[model samples]
Target: MTVAVLFALFTVLLIVGVPIAFAMGLSAVTVVLMFMNVPLVLLPQRFFSSLDSFPLMAIPLFILAGNLMNVSGITAAIVRFASALIGHIRGGLAQVNIATSLMFSGISGSAAADVAAVGSMLLPAMKKEGYKPEWSAVITAASAILGPILPPSLLMVLYGAMTGQSIGTLFLAGILPGLVIALFLMALTWWKADTIGGQKHSRATKAEIGRAFLAALPALVLPVLIIGGIQSGVFTATEAGVLAVVYALLYGFVTGKLGPGLAWHHLRDAAIATSSILIILGGAALFSWIIAREGFPAQIAEALTTLTSNPYLALGLIVVALLILGMFVETISALILVTPMLAPIGAAYGIDPIHFAIVTIISVLLGSITPPVAIILILACRIGGVDYAKVIRPFIPYFLIILAGLVVITYVPAVTLAVPRLFAGYGG
Candidate 1:
C-alpha cells in the first residue's frame, strides 16, 4: 500500500508535468510524512549523502570537459574532421552527423550536450544542403544518443556510483558496442541515402584528410589520455576527469580561443548543466531510500527470478519495462531510480555485471530520443526550427535502427564484453 501510494503520487506529478527532481523529492517526502517513521530530517540527509560519492565527482568534470570542448573551438575541429573522413560518402552530411556525434560523445558524456554542440553545426548544414529539416533534426537527435554509449559517460558513472560496478570497466565495455552501434546507424543512413535526400561529394584529397585529422588531434588525444591514464594506473576515473578538464583549458588557452570571459561563460554553463543532474539525483536519492526501506529491490528481484530462470527472458522483460518507463521519465532520473533495483535482479539471473550495465544504459538512452520526454530530440527540434510533431515521423526509422542495434548488443554478450575483457580482465 505504501509503495502504491509512493508511485501513485510520483505518476500523478509526472502526468501533470512537474519537473522530475521536485516530483521525486515531493513524492518521497509525502510518503514519509504519512506512513514511514523515518524522521523528516532523514529525508534531506539521504539527498545529500547520495551526492557524496567520490566516483560521482567525475560527473561535473566530464560535463565541463565536454562543454569546454564544445565552446573552445574543438567541436568545430571534430566536425571538420568528421566531414573530411566521410562527408563525401552517400548521404554525406548524414554520415558526418553520426561521425561527429561518435567523436564528440567521448568528451561531452551528455546527450543534450551532444545535440547542442553537434546539432548546432550539422543540423543547419544538412538543412541548407536541401535535406528536410525534420530528417536533419531526427538524425542529429538520434546520433546524440551515442554520448552516453561511448566513454566518459555520465550515465555509466551514476550506475557505477550507485551499484559499485567498476566505472573503468563500464567505460571499456562501451567501446565495441558503441562503435558497432554507430556502424549500424551509418549503414542505415547509407542504405536510405535517397530517403534522407543525401548528397555525395568527391572524396577528400589525402592532404585534406591529413590536415583535418591534425586539426582535430588535440580533441582526440583527450579521450585516449583519459582511458590510457586510468588503465595504466596513473589515475582513478575521477582523476581522469580532472585531467580532461586541465587539458581542455590548456588547449583552449594555447589556441587563444578560451579567454578569461569565455572561460567563465562556459564554466557557468557547465555548472548549470551539472547542477541540474545533481538535483535530479538528489531527489532520486530520497525516493530510492524509501524504496530501499520498503525492500522493493528484493521483492522485485524475487518476482523476476521466480518468473524466469532464463537470463535472456529476464533481460527482455526488464528492457521492456525500461523502455516504457523511459517514454515518460527523463533518462538520467529513470536510471537513478532503477539501477539499484535492476542490478540485483541481473545478478540473480547470472548476467555479467558489465554486460548488464551497458545494456541497461543503452535502453534508457533510447528515451532521450523518444517523445514526451525526448529531452535530446527536443533540443534538435529547437535548433532546426522544426516542430516536435514533424521530427517524430523521421525518428521512426532511426528508432527502428537503434532497436535493431540494441537487439544485437543485448543477445550477443561478446559485443559488449569483448573489449572490456581484453582491456581490463572484466567479465567475458
Candidate 2:
C-alpha cells in the first residue's frame, strides 16, 4: 500500500507537469501522511541530512568546473583540436562530435554538460558543412551519452554513495567500456557519412596538426588531473572536484580565455545548474528515506530473492527493469530512486559493487538517449536548430549499437571489473 501510493502520486504529479524534484518531494510527503506513522517534522531533517554527506560536495564543484571551462574558452580549443584531427574524414564534423565528447567526458561527467560544451560548438559547423542539421543533432546527442560512462561521471559518484562502492574503482573500470562506445560510434558515423556524404576537408599539414594538439592540450589536462588525483589517493572524489574548479579557473585565466566578466557569468550559470541537480538529489533522498523507513526495500528484496536465487537472473532483471524505467524517468532521477532499493539485493548475490554500479550507470545512460525523457537529445536539438522528430530517426541504428554495447557490459562483468582489479592490484 505504501509503495503503490508513492508510485501513483509521483506518476500523476509528473504527468501533470510538476517539476520532477517537487513531484518527488510532494509524493514522499503524501506517502508519509497517508501510509506511514512518521511525523511531518521529519521532512526537514531528512532533506538536510541528505546534503550533509561530504562526497556529495563533488556534485556542485564538478558542475561549476564544467560551466567554467565552457565560458573560459576551453571548450572551443578542444573542438578545434577534434575538428583538426577528424575533420578530414568522410563524416568529419560528426566524428569531431564524438571525439569532443570523449574528451569532455573526462572533465564534466555529465552528458547534458557534454552536449552543451561540445554541441554548441560542433552542431553549427556540421550544419554549415552540408550535413543534415537533424542528423547532426541526432549523432551529437547519441554520442554524448558516452559522457556518463567515462571517468569523473556524476552518476559514478551517486552510485558510489548509494552502494558504498569505491568511486576510484568505478572511475577506473569505466575507461575501457567508454572507449569501446566511442570507437563504435565513430564507425557508425563513418557509415552514416558514406550514406549521406557531406562536404569533405583537405588533409592538414603536420604543422597544423601540432598547433591543434598544442591548442587542445589545456582542455585535455583537466580530466587527467581529476582522475589521476583520485586514483593516486592524493584526493578523495570531493577533493578532486575542488581541485577541478581551481584547475579550470587557472587554465582559463592563464590561457587569457577567461576574463572577469565571463567568469562571473559562468559562476551564475554553474550555480543555477548545480542548484537544480542538488534540489533533485535532496528531494529524492527524502523520498528514498521514507520508503526505506517503511521497510519497502526489505520487502522488495525478499520478493526478488524468492523469484530468483541466481545472481545472473537477478542482475538481468535489474538491467531490464532499469531500461523500462529509464523510458519514463530521467536518468539521474532513476539512479537516485532505484539504486537505494537494488544495491542490497545485488550484494546478496555476491555481485561486485563496482560491477553493479557500471551496469546501473550504463543502463540509465541508455535511457538518456531514448524518447520520452532524453534530456541530452532535447538539448542537442535545441542547439542544432533541428526538429526533434527528424533528428530521432537517424539515431535508431546508433542507438541499437550502443544498446548492444550496454548488453555486453551488463553480462560480461570482466569488461567492467578488469580495470578496477588491475588498478587495485598494482596499487597494493
Candidate 3:
C-alpha cells in the first residue's frame, strides 16, 4: 500500500510537470505522513545523510574538473586529434564526432558535457561543411552517451555510491564496453556515410597526426591517471577526482588559457550543475529509505518468484522495464529511484554486481538520447539550430545499433566484466 501510494503519487507529480527531485521528495513525504509512524524529521535527516558520504564529494569535483577543462580549451584539442585520425573517411565529421566523444568521455564522465563540448565545436562545423544538420545532431547525440559508458563516468560513480560497489572496479568495468560502442558507432557512420551527407577530408600526413596527438596528449592522460591512481591504492575515487581537478588547473596555467574571470564563471557553472545533481541525489535517498523501510526489495523478490525462478528471465524483465521507464523519467532520476531496489534483487538472483552495474547504467543512459525526454538529443538539436523533428529519422539507425550493443552487454556478461575482473580483482 505504501509503495502503491508512493509510485502513484510520483507518477501524478511527473505527469503534472513537477521537477523530478521535488517530485521524489514530495511523494516520499506524503507517503510517510499518511502511512508510516516515523516523525517528519526523518525526511531532512535522510536527505542530508545521502549527501554526507565522503565518496560522494567526487560528484562536484568531477563536474568542476569538466568545467575547467572546457574553459581551458582541452575540448578543441581533443577534437583536432580525432579529426586527424579519421577526417579522411566518408562521413568524416560524423566519425570524428564519435572519436572525439570517446576521448572526451574520459575527461567529463557526462553525456551532457560531452554533447555540449564536442557538439558546440563539431555540430556547427559539420553543418557548414555540408553535413545535414539533422544528421549532425543525431550523430552527436548518439556518441555523447559514451561519456558515461567510459571510465571516470559520473553515472558509474553514483551507481557505486548507491550500491556499495567499488568505484574503481566499476570504472575498470566500463573500459571495454565503451570501446565497443565507439568502434561500432564508427562502423555505422561509415556504412551510413551516404545518408549522413558529410564531405570527406584528405587524410592527414603522419606528421599532422603526430602533432594533433601531441596537442591532445595532456587531455588524453586524465583517465589513465585516474584509473592507475585508484587501482594502485594511491588515492580513493574522491582523491582521484581531486587529482583530475588539479591536473585540469595545471594544464590551464601552463597553457595560459584559464583566467580569473573565466575561472569564476566556470566555477559558478559547475556549482550550479553540482547542486542540481546533489538535490536529486538527496530526494532519491529519502525515497529509497522509505521504500526500504517497507521491505520493498523482499516483496519484489518474492513477487518475482511467481513470475519465474530463472535469473536470466528475471534480468531480462528488469532491463525491459527500465527501458520503458527510461523513455519517460530522466536517466539519473530513474537510476536513483530504481537502483536502490533492483540492485539487491539482481544479487538475490546471483548476477555479478559489476556486470549488473554496467548493464543498468548503459540501459538507463539510453534514455538521454531517446524521446519524450531526450535530453541529449534536445541539447544536440539546440546546439546545431536544427529542428528536433528533422533528426528523428536520422536517429533510427544509431538507436538500433545502440540497442544491439545493449543486448550484448546484457546477456554476455564478459563484455563488461573482463577488464574489472582482470585488473581490479572483481568477482574474485
Candidate 4:
C-alpha cells in the first residue's frame, strides 16, 4: 500500500507537467506524510545534507569547466582538429561531428554543453555544405550525448557521490565504451555522408593540420590533467575539478580571450549552473529519504533476489528499469533515488559497485538522447531550429549505435574494469 501510494504520487505529479525537481519533492513529501508519522522538519535536514556532500562539489566545477571551454574557444580548436583528421573522409563534416564530440566529451562531460558548443559550429557548416537541416541537427544531437558517458562526465560524478562508488574508477571505466561509441557513430556518419556528397572533401594542408593541433593543444591537456591526476593519486576527484577550473582560466587568460571582466562572467555562469544542479539534488535527496524510509530498498532487494538469484538476470532487469525511468525523470534525480537502493543489491550478487556505477551512469545518459524528455535533444532542437520529431527520426541509427555500445559496457565487466585494474590494480 505504501509503495503503491508513493509511485502513484510520483506518476500523477509527472503527468501533470510539474518540473521534475519539484515533482520529486512533492511526491516524496506526500508519500512521507501519508505513509509515516515523521515530522516535517526532516525535510529540511535531508535537503541540506544532500547538497552538503563534499564530493558533489565536483558537479558544478565540471559544468563550469565545460562551459568555460565552450566560451574560451577550446571547442573551436578541437573541432578544427577533428575536421583535419576526418574531413577528407567520404562523409567528412558528418564524421567530424562525432569525432569532435568524442574529443570534447573528454573535457566537458555535460551533454547539453556539448551540443551547444559542437552543434552551433557543425550544424551551420553541414548545412552550408548542403546536408539537410534535420539530418544535421539529428546527427549532432546524437553525438553530444556521448559527453556524459565519457571521462570527466558530470553524470559519473553525481553517480559516485550519490552511490558512494569510486569516482576515479567510474571515470576510467568510461574510456573503452566511449571510444567504441565514437568509432561506431563515425561509421554511421560516414555512410550518411556518402549518401549526401554535396561538400567537396579536402585534405588539410600540413600547415593547417599543425595549426589545428596547436590550437587544440591547451584544451586537450585538460582531460589528461584530470584523469592523470586522479589515476596518479596526485589529486582527489574534487581537487581535479578545481584544477580544471584554474586551467581553464589560465588558458583563457594566456590566449588573451579572457580579460578581467570575462573571468567574472565565467565565474557567474559557473555559479548559476552549479546552483541549478545542487537545487535539484537537494530535492532528490529529500525524495530518496522518503522512498528509503518507506522500505522500498529492502522490498526491492528481497523481490529481486527472490525472483532471480542469477546476478546477470537481476542486472538485466535493473538496466531495463533504469532506462525506462530515465525517459521521465532527470538523470541526476534518477541516480539519487535509485542508486542508493539498487547498488546494494548489486553488491549482494557479487557485482562490483564500480562496474555497476559505470553501467548505471551510461544507461541513464542514454535517456538524454531518448524520446519525449530528452534534455540534450531538446537543446539541440532549439539550437538547430528544427522540430523534435524530425530530429528524432533520423536519429534512429545513431541511437542503435550508442545502444550497442551500452550493451557491450553492461555485460562485459572487463570493458569497465580494465583501466581501473591496470591503473590501481585494486579490483582483484
lDDT per model vs. reference: 0.88, 0.83, 0.89, 0.82
Task: Give the local distance difference test score of model 3.
Answer: 0.89
TM-score of 2: 0.94
Candidate 2 local Cα displacement, residue 294, angstroms = 3.0
Q: Identify the candidate with maximal lDDT.
A: 3
Highest-scoring model, TM-score: 3
Least lDDT summed over 10 consecutive residues: which range in candidate 3?
419-428
Q: Write out the backbone clash pairs for model 1.
A: none
- Candidate 4 on 1-428: residue-level lDDT in tens? 87677678877887889877787788878877877787889889988988888888888788777777777888889999989977888777888888899999988898878898999998888888887777888778788877887789888888888877778878888887788778878878777775544586789999899999999988888888898899898998999999998888888878777777877776788788888778778877877776677777778878998999998889888888888877777777777667877877888888988888878877777866788888878887788787888876687887888888888888898887888888867563
Better TM-score candidate (2, 4): 4
Q: Compute the lDDT of residue 393 as modeled in candidate 3.
A: 88
**Model 4 TM-score, 2 decimals:** 0.94
Write out the backbone clash pairs for model 4. Answer: none
TM per model? Answer: 0.97, 0.94, 0.98, 0.94
Tell me the tens digit of each residue's lDDT in model 2 across 1-428.
77888989999999999988999999998888877786788898888877677887788788888887777787788888887887898788888889989988877789988998888888877777788887888888888987888888889888887666777778888988898888888888888886644688888888888898898787787777877788888999999989988888998898788888987887788778768777887889878887787788788778888998888888888888888888788888889888888887777788877788888888888887788777788999999888888866787898888888887887888888778777665221
Candidate 4 lowest-lDDT run of ten: 191-200
Error of 1 at 145 (Å): 0.4
Better of 1 and 4 by lDDT: 1
When sorted by TM-score, best at the front, the candidate numbers are 3, 1, 4, 2
**Alpha-carbon RMSD to native, per candidate:** 1.4, 2.1, 1.2, 1.8
lDDT of 3 by residue, 364-410 (tens): 88866888779899999999999998888888899889888888888
State how far residue 85 of model 4 sits from its true place (Å). 1.3
